[model samples]
Target: MSANDPGHINDLSKDQEESLKNFWISIIDKITNKNKISLEDFYDSTYGNELFNLFASDNPDVVLLRRLRARKWNVNLALEQLINTLEWRFQWGVNQLVAKGESELSYQEILTGKTFYIGYDRFGRPINYISVKNHIKGQFPSETTEKLTVLSMEIGRKLLHCPVESVTLIFDMTEFSMKNMDYQHTYFLFNLLQNYYPESLGLALIVNAPWIFNRCWYIIKRWLDPVVENKVHFINNIDELTKFIDLSNIPKHLNGNKPDFNYIPPTEQDNIMLSAFQNDFSGNKKARENHQQASINYLRITYQWAQTNHNKDLLEQRKKAMEQLRDAYEQLIPYITTRTHYHRYGLIEEPIFYKTYQRIQQENQQESVHF
Candidate 1:
């Protein structure tokens, strides 16, 4: 490739870089505003209040709603604060779990508090006291380095309490590889907990490696049979994880009681709203078509309301009309791309195309001046 070719150089001109940055900032700002407004409107609705109460409790929803309102007004700063809060809460939970002597295998050992050493073998399997101690020294400090560690553990504890004879713990192997012990420590603890404390509760922890999931479908099916399928708890985050364990009624579950809430199904309206949100401004032509059809259907329903209630206030009807217009605009923006059309037709691939054309025009003017 020629040295002057745009692709050959990694750096952009100062003005070009500034233009790109500004474009990205504008897009982020627009998305942030839309996200905040949608979330706020949802929260203010009756169904939103009910959902919030079910998840966060009655008292905390007030605080959460206030934060959410602030986020609607100042989205970027609120998101940063939210991240910090979650991180702090997660660390606090881990500290509490460790302090409760829940980390140790034996209750008697915890009570005695002897300076016992543990060791591991070549494969990092727990071998003896001395080796385990060495492994802990090497890996324990930053072992569970996830934002949702406490919630993940709580889900594990709940799944262990299930009435079924055995349970399978499935995790993303790609994520597991980032950790120090390569998930060996977690596997060992799961097996140990199953064997020593709750012998009846058979535990099988499976790491679903990237390619393995696609190739080993039969193996996964064999493991998830009638015996273990009901007890199995698949977890990606703490919020979705409440399906496996009930945090509110923890003591009852520990004392051999079954969990109260089995699962929460997504409401039909919520599903529709989510589907609308996903396909709203998707770059794909097919997605835009689907969203347009959905918007048409919604408009038809609202139009019927307008017709049936002749006495209904004019302002209410106008408000609904405005919402429909906004939805129409959302559906249309994806299709109208003048700049992208030029690029697709091989007109230009770089911002320098404009600059080069402008420079050529300037040189011709200088030659004309000489003439």
Candidate 2:
């Protein structure tokens, strides 16, 4: 980290940079038992498995920041939280869940369109809608619904581009009643987001929350982390949401401009790559190798960046390696995981996906001045 460039990676301040570096060092030390070890070597070891690949696919710096922010920049606590999350994921077989792709959950869950990503907010964060009205207690098995939620989070992660790390969650509570209330399900979700996916939620809007939800919310709020609880807002009307989301992005059922949720089943064409390479073991092996090498390269660069005290040149190299890793992961997706609605419709490729809050704000200001 150059002294002149305090916000070198992801616009982090000097203190924040120091904390992030400390976190990296601490985790590395734990993994290496205080012995010096190169990142490439560790990445090749048994410890650096699929979960490590998952973290690499997600920009590791951003992932670290998410945990740090969740713990208010406390390195030790963030480390604990992250370790717990990794342990949970391993125990819960999250890698297999992701590897199995969209089919792991029942078709009924997909048809209900209970949860899905739509358009993004003004700041380019994807908006994930949870159709509370469609969900009835015990309608689906606990494991199935949990998997659906994890799949949704995994998809949401893909939608996030740089400078837009979180997603807005709208729990559309229109026509909500006592039968729709699932306290256990709600607890699992909030706990998962707060602990495992810290800072992944930008905002949560309880839209059209029925009068019955009041009692339920009182209990639910107690289960949330203070930071997460603060992000939850009750929206009585669509206009109130416009402060964050443009009307064009909101669903029409909520009296906004966009159409309601529609589930598009994955067609054969959607899995064209998988179909093409199904029997070609050599091709799949090569793709996996490419992705693995790219991931290791990223970790190697990141380790150098940290060891060099965040040298400006090493930071740039780290960034380039991160991009290479992301590209590799995308190339490997078709082979490793099945295509979801986001890929089929190219939702994440929309122009809005590339915009940052600063760019959007500048454009909005220019429009206001023109008027």
> In candidate 1, how many clashes are counted?
12
Q: For residue 300, give model 1's deviation from the true position in Å.
A: 72
> Candidate 2, residue 125: CA error in Å?
1.3
Tens digit per residue, CA lDDT, model 2, 1-371: 11122233447877898888888877766655533556655655444553465574677777787788778889999988887887788778787787777878889888897898888998778999999988899999989999999988888988887667789999999899998899999999998899988878889999899787889999999998887888899998877988879989988888889988777777864455345535446656776788778877876666566666647888788878988887777656545556677866678552221222234346558969999
Clashes (backbone N, CA, C under 3 Å), per candidate, total 12, 2
Tens-digit per-residue lDDT, 31-58, candidate 1: 3364564432433333332222222211
lDDT of 2: 0.76
Error of 2 at 344 (Å): 2.2
Give the Cα RMSD of candidate 2.
Answer: 10.5
* Candidate 1 TM-score versus the reference: 0.18
